[model samples]
Target chain A: MENACCIVGLGAISSIGLDVEENYESLQSLQSGISYPEFLQTLHKTDLPVCEIKKSDAELAALCKMPLGLPRTVYLSAIAVQQTLAVIANHDMSKLRIGFISGNTIGGMDRSEYFFTDYLQNQSQGQLQDIRYHECGSITELVAKHFGIKHFVTTINTACSSSANAMIHASRLLKNNKLDIVIAGGADALCRFTLNGFNTLMILDSEPSKPFDENRKGLNLGEGAAYLMLTSEAIRSEYNLHKYATLSGYANANDAFHQTASSAEGNGNYQAMKEALAMTGLTTSDIHYINAHGTGTGNNDASEGIAIQRLFGENIPPVSSTKANTGHTLGACGALEAVYACLGLRDQVIFPNLRFETQMKDLHFSPDTKWQATKNMQHIMSNSFGFGGNCTSLIFSKDS
Target chain B: MGVYIQGIGNISAQIFDPRSQDFTLHAGHGNRLICIEPDYKDMIPPMQLRRMSKIVRMGIACAKAAMQDAGIVKPDTISLGTAYGCLADTEFFLQKLITQDESMLTPTAFIQSTHNTVSGQIALLLNCTGHNFTYVHRGHSFETTLQEAFMLTQENVNCNALIGGIDELTNNAFNIISRFGTYKKEDEHFNNEGKGCIAGEGANLFVVNAKDTKSSYAYCSDIHVCSTENIAEELDGFLHVNQLQASDIDTCLLGLNGDERYDTIIANNIRNVKNARTISFKKYCGEYPSSGAFAMALACKLLQSNTTPMNLQDLNAPLNDEPAQRVLIYNHYKNQYHSFILLNRL
Candidate 1:
């Protein structure tokens, strides 16, 4: 039997809020975080809409109790990790063999860009310390150092699916008896690099994103951090920890079709969902709610919608994309949405998919437009698909 | 569920096979030791080569060669490790954004700038829909990749994973980092003594499978990664689990850069294992995040022949005994991340 990897603690910092409860409160009221850029200064700031956290770098650093000059991503991650440690505060962390696996795409581009801007005009103007944060793993390393975690710290960078992959790897480690406790999640901060990158792709939606809608334009790139404290069932018992949810099933697959786009049929998406369900020994019927990847892009919603129908068939349950609530966070979306799934399971309420008027012409069902109270919300399936055809599906079961 | 290395492909500072009986050494002088990369046309298509950076070229080449040596068209999974991924592209795009206006910037460089591009590219080329992963921890990058691969063997008895560690050296990166007093100085430089590491870069790939084959070099017995202060305790615990003692390790491959600040962890961990032969690989390969992968390839070569390379011997710590069965590798990055890998001769 596969060992159960229970979720004992959860932390998230998005545009909506700085902590789990605040974000959940927003979700309960169907408050979306999408807005005009505030802190992210870019040429496209006036042109594009993004779900940016309304905090200055100094403000974020103060919130995390860290010094200035820290990367925005590091500050965001410190907030989330603080919240995670808060929930699991009573447990003796030193006794357990802990491992931290983080998912991040933009390591410290925000800082690096500033350094480069200064250095371009003058060769020696850029701070050398800022360059140290360029690698994706540095986010986790810095966070780990702050928390005094020394074992098995690493980072994953698979575009949007990075955090979900982090969760999968963490669960595997716990199940395989490599680490007793694992904190796995991801973080990314808004910067000119991502804004221009998405702009160059011409996928930044001018208006708020409309996921799973026929009139959906494109993704509204967002930024934040989310982390989950995962522990083996035995460790939970030993610590007498309260379980928020149990990571019942998870799987990853490559689309092998395109670099940034999903296949028309969403073959990789279908395979991931199938294998995730297989891992849990559950059928499609067991999933009560589905948190679709739904980036609100023309290709993703259609592709993911098709894959949903192919997997669940005529009896598709309450399904929606929270990307409409929180813009596509890229690497952070996986864990951000996973936290949302956990919230849904705990609250037994499905957050409304903010914007959906007409059903997507290509799909049979439109996303649940209003907040729906689900009955027997035992299992919630969350999907995160990213660039390079990386697709992942994670199923969270109610803590029984 | 034993995992054995079935194939090896390396693009070190010198583009040579470690498994070859006779190999040419690329002794780099001074503080920079860039890789001697192969022709792009040899592995990638003409159009593909034009789009990739040097790191991607080396990554794809090594991954393809590993698969080729394993006699498989596609691997069951693809895992890549890079401390600083595609820095040249990242730096290039950053320079353009700084110099040229960002309004008309193209997405090609941005699209290819992500850390996961090489692994994704490999998966796309092979059309393997298996799990694709990329790790980006500093010193523990390759260790974490192999650790995850090791864990995969427990889940599935029959699994084949294409694992690689790649990083590139750029003049700008080198110049910028050298200011931190990281690289040794030999002249009127930062240190003014010019005794720093010869900054090296390369991509090393290995095909690891649950089952051994005729081409298998050695069995990868175990691996451990930690970030604690207890180096000796961790080493003792790791060897204890594998039914090994200090004397059992016939060869100890240490990640000893010329820098004295970083060699203490390695020195203490292997202090009790005085009976085993010790070799330092950083001299030949230079120092990079994933140089451990190159060290592992070198360890595999050492296991096959039990003879340490002439260029790899640590002059101060020469071996009194010949290598035999077991080789233990210990590597750390500036006292932050530590990794241990144990391999046994096939």
Candidate 2:
């Protein structure tokens, strides 16, 4: 029998709210985190709408209780990590053997960019330390240190699919008996580096992102972090822990069709979903809802819609893209959506896919744009597709 | 439960292949740092070559060579582990962003900057749309990739998997890391002199399979990764789990860069293994986050040759035996991450 990996705790901070509860409440009320850029100073500030966190660097650092002068990304990640750790307080810190895996595309880039111009002039001496935080692993190291975790630690940087891949790696390690407990998720803070990068790609939507809509322009770049505490069933049972949801199946596949674009038919996304379903031994009928990867971009929504249509046939499950609320959190979207899936299973509710309107002419399906509470929700699938044709699908189910 | 390395291909600073039999060690670029990249035109087609960066070229070359070595036309899965994926492309895109102010930036460079580009490109090249994933966790990146491959093989998901670690050197990257004191500056160059062990890059590919072939060099017994500030305790625990004592290891592959501060951790770890002869590869391969892959490739070659190269030998200890049966490879990057990989002759 496959060992069940259970999520004991979940924490999230996005443009919507600070924790899971607040975010859920906002989702229920149709509150959009999307707004005109205020925190990030960029050339496209007037043109782009982002789902940015309300906290400042100093405020976030204080909330995380981190040392001063830390990178913004680390500060935000520590906040979410500490919140998740608070729930599993009873678990032994010394003998638990916890591992940490994070996903981030731009780690400490906000700080690094500040130091970049100054360092070039050889005028700043202390700023050189900021360069250490440029690598993706540095923030993960900082988070691990905050919790005193010494076991396996890693950072995944496959763009949008980073956190989804991180979650998959964590679950796989738990199943292989490599780790007893693991905290896996991702964080990406807003900065001119990322904002400008997306702007240059011409994928930043001026208005609110409309995922799977015919008139969708592009994505709204958002920022924040989310993480889950995953442990083997044996550990959970031994500790008498409350399970949030079970990570039933996950699969990662490469599109190999383009460097940044998905295949014309979404081959990689389809294969990943198929394999994830196969791993769980679950039929299409078993899936209750799907949290789509819909970034509101012309390419991603269309590709992911085609993949979803191919997987479930014409009668698709009620699918929705929460990017309307959180924008595209990039690396954190996978874990963020995973947390949403768990919440769906817990409350027996399907959150509305905000900003979704007319179905695409290329596909014959529409998303559930209205929030509804239903009973007996079983399986929920979440998808995250990234720049390198990296596609990941994770299935979370209620404990039987 | 052991994973066998059926075939291996490596492109490093030293040419250590059976066909070439060229074990000559060449220092990288300046002083003692340089990356020895092969002529990839012979391996990759011209059309693909235009879009390929150094990392991509090196990865494709090594992957093709590994598949050829394993006598397999196509692998069931492709997994790549890279710390900084496609650094050349990343630098190119960053340069365009900074200089051009984000206008008319080529999408090609920006698209290829992702960590999974190597695995995705390899899959495209072969047209085998099997399981493909990439791990980008600093030093432990390659170890985790192999661990996943081992798990998949154990699960019978695929009998054979193509796994490799590839990182490329860039001028801007070196300059940036040098400013951070991670790499040795020219003024403080005397301490890091003679051994020009700075950040260098190349690719090392391996074909790991459930079926043990007669040509297998070694079987991977186990692997571990830890992020503890205390190295000694982690080492002891890792050794204890394998029912191994430090003295039982016949050889130790240490990732001792010429850096004074970071090399101490490696030296202290080697002190635990009293009876083992220490071997260092960074002096030849230079230093990169995923350089452990190079050390692993060297371990497989040592198993096959039944001999250690003089260039790799540590002057402090002499080889006790002509052929070593067991090897312990320990590597760390800047004291932040550490990994232990155990290999034995099959």
Candidate 3:
């Protein structure tokens, strides 16, 4: 029998909040964390709005009890993973086989870009320590070592959908009986490299993002880290764990349409949602809420909306894009939104999509724009699509 | 279930033409072993080829060649691993953005700077809308790709996975990594006792299926990656689970990169094995995060030919006269990321 992956703990550190409780409170009050950049060293700070965490790198390091000079990505990840490990503080976890699967597009580019400024001037001038954590895997290794997780650790980079893939890979490990507990998520820090990269693509919105809206200009880049602690069914039963939800179904599909853009018809989006639902043996009407991958971009919202319409049709559930609040945390959005989805099941509340005024012309359904209490919410779906046409949808069902 | 290596393609420091009998091994040139790239005119169109970065071109060429060798038009899945992905493009955009003050920059380099660009471009070129994935773990990157491919084939019997591992060594990357004592100095001698190994880069791809076919090179039975202190015990457990022993392995491909710090893991395992012929592969391909792909390709070549290649006869010592049937590949990166892959002939 295939083992069911259970979500026992959740940790999140984003622009709106520092912990899951803070995030939930913000979601309850319909507060958006989108603002101008204060920490990232970029020239377009005034012109570009981002969902940047207010803490500086040094502040974050001090807060997380980590070394001062490590990459901000490491600091953010340490904070989130620390919170995640807190759930099992009373239990001795060293005996269990734990796996750490982290996803990120930018590893230490926040510092590597600074290293390059000097190295590009003179080949041997830059400090080698700055580029030490340049590889994406290095971030995971540091965080894993910090938490003393030594069994199995890996890194995945599938652009914006990176963490979603990490969670899926973690579930696979659980199903294969390779691990007892898996902490999977992703983290990305705002750096000049990615900011300029998005700017070059003409996708950075000057204002707060408006996902699933007719006037959606583009996505505001964000920085954050989030993680979900999953365990095998056997481990869950053995521990008699307090379950938030069961990661009942998930799937990954390739659009193959474009490198950075989604197809108009959302082929990959449709396939991923369909496959995930099929895995859960659930029909369209069963999903009570959807945390859409609506990045407020012209291509993503329309494509995702069309896919939702095609799948749910007249019986579309309460759908909302938290990107308006979180400002599209890139690689971390998948797990971050996943935590929100679990909160929807736990607290029975459907978080609102902020700044959404007019509906898009292609879709018939309008997203939920106000925070409302939902009764008897059973299953919530979280969608994450990224560059390279990587699309993933994860379904979390309330524990009966 | 084990997966069959139906086809293989590699672009490495050594000459990698499968049809040609002559395999020329290139020595490291001043602490770097650069890939002897083949002309991509035949594999990629001129218009699209113009905009591709070096790693992307190498990746696409290898993927296409592997597909041709497998005689398949499309694969059921596309997955890959790269430690330093599209370094040239990343450097280009970052340099331009910094030099131009982050204004008036073009999007081409920025668009291709992502780590998944090669896998994405290959999917775009092939129009294969399968489940695409990319892994960026330092040393275990390629092993994770293989594991995912194995799981896909295990889940769906009809799945054919086109998977590979690729890394490109750019000038800036080499210089930065060199500062961290990752590579030998240009004036230093190349010896096992040295502190650093030669830096290298390549793209090695394979077409894998669940069942053995007429063109099968070898069957990958098991793969494991972990960070452990007692490698000898781990090796015993791995072999025990696979229903094998140290003596059952005919040959063991060891990643003995010249560095003593890194080679200790492989050295510790070599002391425990009894009868397996130990051979180090880093001399041919040098040291990179995903160099295990090159080692796997070499293992597949040996298994397919049922004999040692002439170029690798003196890796550590002369190969055993008997034809090898089973091979074990053990590799590690910076003494942390350890992996073992077991391959056997049909």
Candidate 4:
């Protein structure tokens, strides 16, 4: 089979670690990154825990070589993107028609909130510059400029499923022969606005998230950025480089069941998974591991589990939700988990779904609670479902 | 691959129905803000209507109208593009968090605050769980969705895709934008009187299909979205890639919103596209983030009607028998992000 899109390099910053190696090390050790919020100044810090990246905005700005006063999201994205690009530094930045697509939920909210308070005090002159960064696109534009990418840049903000859709979009563009090199992923930073928003919804877990557990509470908010360098087969062959994993198939569907809650039957999730497998020409038996969205919410886990059960039947693959490790990174969760999927292939290990006790009575399947290495890791399917019933499934395979 | 615009619906400052002969223009309310309050109850059911924000309501209303216009009961896909999604809800949630100290914040506002809420709601409403996505790339948000629709068409995946772009203005949102100096102050609008205009909100939806139905208004030939500091170089590169010369463009729709700072950049590019008729829509639609969607809707109507609306006609070029063969829409939001869309009548 011809590889549709090849992942050349990957980078990520999460509560687990700062880079790919660090995150992989933490994952292999079965360490959870969910802890009390430290950096974000919020009133609910004590009540709600978060998977926050252990870095300040100034430190991240310095790490990304960004100027002072840059939006915190941009700074985080630049660090992750720069790390990914470092692996492919020999590639011609000027000759290659490079493009970027990022998914971020609260783009530049850190800056927007700052200016929102200032505007109320009648201080508005220097504020226009911040306005440019208020929308999701501004982060993409800033990252593209920092990386010297000049073509086909945009941002997708479909909540938790944003970066998964971003990855799908990048793959489709490459399959259509639209560009040579594309950087696709998502980044998000912990903020008081999001912290309180989730808290108000009464979905924030007081303790660490227990995904797929019998007594699972709500999710723990997280912040991070991750990106992958996707190139076509021709480009990979010309460069004489090894592709980590082939992004074989991807699909997105709307749950449309609710504004926030998925349907009881998980129709959208089922359709997305079915379409993705169908596109890849693979059956449920071919898949060795499943990276579930498993936000630890009562509704999401139950709905997603039902959908997975419907698709795979009794022959369910070993499944784990990385959200227990990285928290629910929202827009960046998809990309963050994509990096973890590649790691699963390289290491031949299925990371544990931490804090699982008993299976839900509604479903027979249970996520792998212990990390185990397997040889037949050919295909790994990951699911990312967001608000607005936006659901996406991505299939990655070792053999192209 | 041919993608036809089967249905078009828009809710802007002006009446955007294609059947209408003239724009049902409204008087500017004192500060240069133009708003169109649609009777959304006609399109949305009362049960679902109560929960929707202004952006969601406008989006549902416009999407419903577009589906009706296309005579399609169920669309295969729903794709929405919004520069800022559910800002009103977002602001509400944020305000609750800040003012109430994050206690008892309503779930409704938080639920509708995601960027994909509109597209998700549309899918849920139609119960069409096929393919759904949303793009939030500022000025090129809708164009990116159009590009994705074209790719889907080329793949023969779905026959029809409902694509739309929407943005709503809230008081906090406007104030935030004003603080950045991106928005014209009330004093500036009052002093210049007619010089600078305030921002507005709107929703534009289109039913795009792979087949070229006779009802097609025009064919979207190509769309190019790039981020560059040098406007001249980017413009030249876009035209060169399409194998089109500057003179080949019969009319160029420029995004000029009376802001002298940014309008000059567009003006300089228009001057380079020699022998092409120029037009602007900012005065009519105001300067919202996704105003480009409104511009695209106007282009479709112009191609179909064979006449440009008088309110939008900046350059008085006589209509020719050539039938507005090629139309180029050049849009820039905040003078930082730019997009160019090329459309040709089939």
User: Model 4 residue A394 lDDT?
Assistant: 96
Predicted candidate 1 versus true structure: per-residue lDDT over B231-254, tens digit per residue: 888888888999988888877888
The deviation in Å at residue B258 for candidate 3 is: 1.8
Query: Predicted candidate 3: interface RMSD?
Result: 1.0
Q: Which structure is stronger by lDDT: 2 or 4? A: 4
lDDT of 2 by residue, A15-119 (tens): 998888888899899988988777776556677789989877888888888987777889878888887888768656677778899999877777766665565
Residue B166, candidate 4: Cα error in Å is: 1.0
lDDT of 4 at A169: 90
Ranking by DockQ: 3, 1, 4, 2
Candidate 3 docks at the CAPRI level of high
Question: Which DockQ values do the candidates obtain, in the order shown?
Answer: 0.75, 0.53, 0.81, 0.66
**Superposed Cα deviation of residue B249, candidate 1 (Å):** 1.9
Encode model 3's per-residue lDDT on A63-166: one tens digit a residue: 78989888899998889989887878888777799999999999999888888888879898877878899999999989999888988898999999999999
Candidate 2's docking class is: medium
lDDT of 3: 0.88
Tens-digit lDDT track of model 4 for B1-346: 5477888888888866864545545535444465576887778889888988888888888888898989898888888889888898887776666566657677778788888888878887888787788899877788888888888888774568899788898877776565555666675542243334567888989998877778887888777775567777878888898888988888887887777777777887666787676776666677877787788887787787655545545644433433467789898876766778888877
Give the better candidate number (1 or 2) by lDDT.
1
Question: For model 4, what is the error of residue A69's alpha carbon versus the real structure, in angstroms, after optimal superposition?
Answer: 3.2
For model 1, residues A1-400, the per-residue Cα lDDT tens digits are 2566899889999998889999998888888898889788776667798999999999999988888897899999989988887866765667778888899998989989988887778777788878778878888888988887766788999999999999999998887787888889999999888888888888889999998888988989899999999998888888888888999998999999978889999999999999999999989999999999988999999888899999999999888888887898888999999998888888898878888887889999888888887678899999999888899999999855
- Computed on alpha carbons, the lDDT of every model, listed in order, comes to 0.84, 0.81, 0.88, 0.82
DockQ of 1: 0.75
| Each model's Cα RMSD | 2.1, 2.5, 1.6, 2.5
